[model samples]
Target: MTHSPQLWQPLQYGTAEWQRVYFRLRNAIEGMNGFGKDPLYECLESGGTHRIRGIAAQAVLVAFQLAHANKRKLATWAGSIAVDGNRPHRRATRRRKTKPLGSWNHEGYLTEPSE
Candidate 1:
C-alpha cells in the first residue's frame, strides 16, 4: 500500500487509550528519576510540570493520539539528534618535543638553534 509522505496528518484518541498511554509514559519518566512525585502530580492535573516534562508529555500525547487514530496499522516514527563525528578533538595532554628549541632574534625573526 502507498502512504502519503507528509508529517501533518491529524491525530485522534478515544476511550481509555489516552489514559493508558499517559500512565505508561508517566511510569517511564518516573523510572528515569527525572520526574519526581511533585512533577507527576502536577502533570496529572495540568498535562505537565517542568519544562522537560511538559515537552515530553506533549510529544507522548501526540504519539498516543496518533496511535489511537491509526490503530494497529498506524506508523509512528521517532528520532534522536546525533553528532556524526564532526566535532573537533581537544588534546587531553600536552606533548613534549625532543627537538632542540629554536630561538627568536632581537628583531623577532626565528633563527636555527646553534649547535
Candidate 2:
C-alpha cells in the first residue's frame, strides 16, 4: 500500500472494520437501486416513464422519483417497526466450517531398501 497518497473518500481500505462498514453501505445502495429499477415501483430504466426532452427536466423527474422511493421506504420501515416492536433479533449466520488440514512432516526417503 502506497503511503504517500492517503486513501480519502474511504480512509480504511483492507481492514476488517472497513469491510463491515462498506458491505452495509453497499447493501443499502443496491437495495435502493433495485427499488428504483423495479417496473412496479420507479421504472427508472424506461425512458417513456419520464417523457422529458431536456436533461434538467429528466433530472427533476428522477429527483422526484427518488423522493417517492424514500417516502415509500420510510413508510415500510415505520410500519414494520410499529407492527412488531418486539421482533426477535436474528442470530449471526455461522461461516462454512472447513475440515482441518492434517499436519504433514517430511522424512528422509531411502532410494533402496537395506539388505
How well does each candidate superpose onto the true structure, as a TM-score? Answer: 0.19, 0.60
Clashing pairs in 1: none
What is the C-alpha lDDT profile of model 1 across 13-78, one tens digit per residue?
A: 543766778788889766533322234222323433323446777777655544443442222121
**What are the runs in model 2 whose C-alpha is more than 4 Å off?**
1-10, 83-115
Give per-residue CA lDDT, model 2, range 5-73, as digits (tens): 543645468699888899999998998999888899889888879988899999999999999988988
100: Cα error in model 2, Å: 46
- Model 2 Cα shift for residue 56 (angstroms): 1.1
lDDT of the candidates, in the order given:
0.48, 0.77
What are the runs in model 1 whose C-alpha is more than 4 Å off?
A: 1-14, 34-115
Which pairs clash in model 2?
none
Cα RMSDs of all predictions? 19.8, 15.9
Question: Highest TM-score among the candidates is held by which one?
Answer: 2
What's the CA error at residue 46 for candidate 1, in Å? 25
